[model samples]
Target: MIEQLGPPTLFFTLSSANTKWPDLHKLFPKTQSNTVHHNRMQFIENLVNNPHITTLYLHLRFQIFRDEVIVKQLHATDHWYRYEWQHRGSAHIHGFLWLPQAPNIDNLDSSNHESIQSVKNLFDQYITTWNPRTEVDHLNKQYIPAISNPCLSNTGVISRSEPCTDYTELVNVVQCHMKCLEYTCLKKNSTLKCRYKAHWPEQHDSSLTLDHNNNPSYKPARNDSRLNVHNPMMLAIWRANVDCQAICSKKAILQYISKYVSKTEHKSESYIDILKRIVGLINSEDTILLAYHRFMMGIVADRDISTQETCHMLLKLPLISCTRQFVNLNVGKKIFQL
Candidate 1:
């Protein structure tokens, strides 16, 4: 009820008369047209099924190995404002390979189709709001600078005048891959982050094809040299259950609280000073403090907990007068929910 229909619905659904009647279609746009909104909802849906979405693959799938040996290459020099206007720099040998996978979106075909269509529909949907004869048609022609740039392609680089449908597809593929990795992390025991990309020559074209020798035709790995991004594994940490320590260690609880606090992004005179704000009030401000405490409580509470227990644990001040408030909690909306 809160996430969908949202807050505005309550305002209108309860009170009929208003001096200013706003447009409902704009706020409650047709579900078909809101790709971003749908993607967000879909992502939330995916999180419920698995916290570690395939996106976690970036941290789990690839490995990048580095060596300290430095080699100097005489490439084109550009006179930049930085580096004292020096054009020469040394490159390190970071060896790696980029492997591709046929991603499985819950092994469902419709999910894959929707993921792809979301990218296209978003672009097309935007064009619909503009005047077709002038602004829309004129903007379409301006894409040649990015699409037809000979300088980047000939040199084994893939640069676009603008990030187009193809670029969006590539991004979605990466995101889906990461989400899968996140799924693995949650079920297992590791924190992962992906930071790899297909190499220069292989990435030179949108086709992303390779030759018989398994090398990019335009920009071979030998020409570019470094290979660290080949396999996706980037960062790893121990993954355990969400840390809840109001009844356990205060330190671990502090770290968990820090993650939540960082989301607020308040400025202090300096860092590490969060102690000044959230420490002693662990009991009061039940509105905000208890809200999060209740959310964290959800981390460990089993599905069978009675409504009275849940309401007391989470909502220190319940909005509803009845004892059935706990019946409203659903499984899919929160990051750590079922």
Candidate 2:
């Protein structure tokens, strides 16, 4: 809680299969099933029991924490969020918000032109790199940011007569590598062309600068590698790899969303990947992608051990101050038929 609910003025990431879920073509409709691995395991179990994709994923997680049109459209005062299921089993949402009259980074006064135009009007009203000339802005054209530069992969034991360094001391740093040449190079070689290189040519348009932890964020334009964005309704209900940002401090967005909210289980494989997944020798689409990544990592580790035993029995219970307003705790408006 960033030392008891303080830092975090917007930071976002929400994903759960994109193309705005039509529930696997409306509950497995296109199937001419020849046991195409049991029609892709009944189309991933009817796209995970889709009741309109769990009612638009619980109405976009309760309109991003109780909507008054998204709390006056992101003027949001307080929020903290976590939900991860990934490993291709979708549902990834890491949010943090706390505007509190935005811009007060230790009293920012960068040669005060009204405090740098109030931090460039809070990064032009909460981030944009420019990509939606409105076709009803269909979610900023799925976050444009293209890339074919995966450390320029030709991974057949390096041999490209060397010569490809120029990272220029990691320009705006955010580096991670490994996984060579699937659709072409992101890593695996000694050189570098683009994980985020080729001289930063991808952010589409939205620049205020300073953030590689120096704070004062917002920088979006990039074309040659493609990264222009301006979130069309959070990429139309969190489809694209939406990563809205603003927070520069609060210990760097609390060590970046607490490394995706207590991330662990990098891997586990006891009986040699479970006897190659119980003698079937895997490959039924990699055993339905390893049983949809171990059934959403065992339902997110049993909902984090039942939310830490209901926060240790509500810290040995003893406080109840009910005013007049009862009900509506908003369990995402409770519609769970499936």
TM-score of decoy 2: 0.26
What is the per-residue lDDT of model 1 for residues 38-120, given as tens digits with 9 covering 90 to 100? 23344333333432222222112111111111011111011010000001111011111111121221232343556434333
Which stretches in model 1 have alpha-carbon errors above 4 Å? 1-42, 51-56, 60-294, 297-338
Question: Using Cα atoms with residue i matched to residue i, what is each candidate's TM-score against the true structure?
Answer: 0.16, 0.26
CA lDDT, candidate 1, residue 104: 20
Q: Residue 237 in candidate 1 has what lDDT?
A: 11
Per-model C-alpha RMSD: 25.9, 20.3
Of the candidates shown, which would achieve the greatest TM-score relative to the real structure? 2
Model 2 lDDT, residue 245, Cα: 71
Report every candidate's CA lDDT: 0.23, 0.45
